[model samples]
Target: MQYLKRYLLICIAFICILLGIIGIVLPLLPTTPFFILALACFARSSQRFHQQLLNSPYVGPILADWEADKRIDKQRKKQIMLMIVCSFAVSIWLLQAQFHLQLLLIVIMFILLFCIKRIAEK
Candidate 1:
């Protein structure tokens, strides 16, 4: 059972890391969330994998800072929020759904923006 759990975590971590790499080239796909997941899973399942992730140039510093401080810097928070908003806006505009769907998306985006703003402020 323990081995199974570890195997699953490693698999998930690998998949997340792959997705994170893909997200680097795809503007719409998020990078941080997947890297974070990979970090977490690797931390639990494999020290070597965790070290490799921590040594990664693109995401290593952010992960290190997050692990050490449990918080993202203000500048990074703002940048992440901007990216999220822009991506959401693009998604909303591209959708050919009904008015209700647009309204719902706007509301959800607003709520998410508000939450991100609050987190960034803190």
Candidate 2:
């Protein structure tokens, strides 16, 4: 049962990592949340994987900081906000013919911004 559980967690972790990567290209999917989930899973299933994730140059420090204090640095927060805005803007512009979808995207963008704003800064 323990082995099965570990296997399951490892699988879930990989899926989360994949989704996190995809989220980089598709802004609506979100990146950090998935990576965070992956980190949690790896922490439980494999210490090596957990350490590797923590050592990732791109997200490593951010994840490590989050794990330690659950806060993001001001500069990183600003970059995230900018990325969200730019991606949503491009998406909305591309879907100009679909007014309802555009409204939906706008709503989602605001919601994402609000959620990000709520996170405590480091």
Question: What's model 2's TM-score?
Answer: 0.97
Give per-residue CA lDDT, model 2, range 60-113, as digits (tens). Answer: 988999999999999999999999999999999999899999999999999999
**lDDT of model 2 at residue 107?**
99
C-alpha local distance difference test of each model:
0.80, 0.95
Please write out the lDDT profile of model 1 over residues 1-122, one tens digit for every residue. 99999999999999998998887765455678789899999999999999999998879998888767667788888887787777777767877666777677777767756765665232
Score candidate 1 by TM-score against the native.
0.76
Clashes of 1: 0
Inter-residue clash pairs, candidate 1 = none
Whole-model lDDT, model 2 = 0.95
